[model samples]
Target: MSFTDSSKKSDPANPKDGSSSESEKPSNEKQPTKTRGQNKKLDRSSKPKTPLPQKMDEEDLGICIQITEKLSNSVYAFGFRSPPDPTDEDGQSYLSATESPMDFQTLLNKLNTEGYRTVNEWKNDMNLIFDNAFNYFAPKTMRYDSAIKLKDKFTDLCQMFTKSEEERWMIKIEKLCNKYISADNEQ
Candidate 1:
């Protein structure tokens, strides 16, 4: 035999059925109310305020240290090279390098043997300069200046390499050095 479902039928003692038993009385109506203890309100205004310290992780700290070191070296090199020479009213320094009588052809030939096809190409590649100067006792500032001057002359010669090209390459390199130093100081 199939059992009839009783889910739809309401109990006689339930309030919804409009009938009640003593056991089915509402506890809120029958029970006495309890008084709240102490009634103490919190003084939120009296709480102490403190600032949180900024958090930097180990990896970030390491990166910051490395960047700082690179920048410090760059700054030291710049100082060594151009040591705060007096500037004219036009803002140009008197410390400019004049043309030397020495033959730079031997040096250019040496550079060519090391895979630099042109002086302009050599100046364009920072990685090449870095590789060449990595173990040299030569001043970095001088090397950087030569690279910049070469680029300037190259632009004038080609007429194809615009101001934007100089901006994209030479100016960007200088800015990167400055940024690296700045980031290093922040750490």
Candidate 2:
């Protein structure tokens, strides 16, 4: 007999249907399969991409102030004097100087004077030097005052000058001042 005819035959004990097996029915009777690609396409079309945020000049200024404040706080916490109050003479000197007093030039000078051959050598012991200086010269009250002054100067600079220019000055000042204080303490 043909395979189809054999499958159509029913057993005497179970005669609910003429077919012996349910799987022998046509595949067209079953539902279609869903794929991962199809599901992803549907998900993509359902939602849109979020737009990028806009940049602002004011945000840059705010960031500059934040950086300055942090540097100031760190210097004070490490027991260094806050920046000196600028008198008219100090202001004039600062303006006339080719570079900011806080610049790395001072650091280079200190390293040379101390007989260090490389910048890396100075950088390695920088923290210890800073701590020793802080312990020697900076009273608790001075640290508090310096932190406050540093915050104020940062705000004033942000309002009065360009962010990038102010940042250069602030960085130079921070490094030089820290180095000087530390060196003095070492003595």
Candidate 3:
């Protein structure tokens, strides 16, 4: 199995052309001291080093906790933003912050249950004022675009329903609410 054994078995008629001896003669080339196995073992010993978790300061942690509490108690549940995105930043602030968010279907269901006709009948308690009102019917980017009151927005909505037959208080309210639903107010 050794190099010498192979050389002896070769036909002498055709010489290896000193290729066999070339490996025997050490050249100026630097050789690796360790075998591949040894190198791999060393690599394994080194381990995959990873950065440690950065420690948070107690004060900073406490401050974050405080902010979370304030946001939870803030009453203004923004239609667009969750807790990760706070109220102050987006101005989705509603007077009835504690109210749950309401979509068109939920509003309809509420109307059915409450026997209400117009937003005026229920007041602007739909949580659709300021950010809530503006954000209704608005795309994500245009959500906070219009900062109008619930009543004004309702008026604008009235223009859309030009027909007098649809001028019923409930119908007008439905049209507006369907287009621009904000959040739901608690009982």
What lDDT tens digits, residue by residue, belong to model 2 across residues 1-187?
1112344556645646754566554466666677767655445755787643332233343443344345435554443323223576744443343122232233334433543443234333333333333333335566446545544554455453444767857876897899999999999
Off by over 4 Å in 3: 1-100, 117-119, 126-141, 146-153, 159-187
Which prediction has more favorable lDDT, 1 or 2? 2
TM-score of 1: 0.16
> Which regions of candidate 1 are displaced past 4 Å?
1-104, 107-140, 160-187
Which candidate number maximizes TM-score?
Answer: 3
lDDT of 2 at 18: 58
- Count of backbone collisions within predicted model 3: 4
**TM-score (C-alpha, index-matched) for candidate 2:** 0.19
Model 3, span 5-39: residue lDDT tens: 24445443445553344335547898879866776
- In angstroms, the error of model 1 at 35 is 87
**What C-alpha lDDT, on a 0 to 100 scale, does residue 4 get in candidate 2?**
23
TM-score result, candidate 3: 0.23
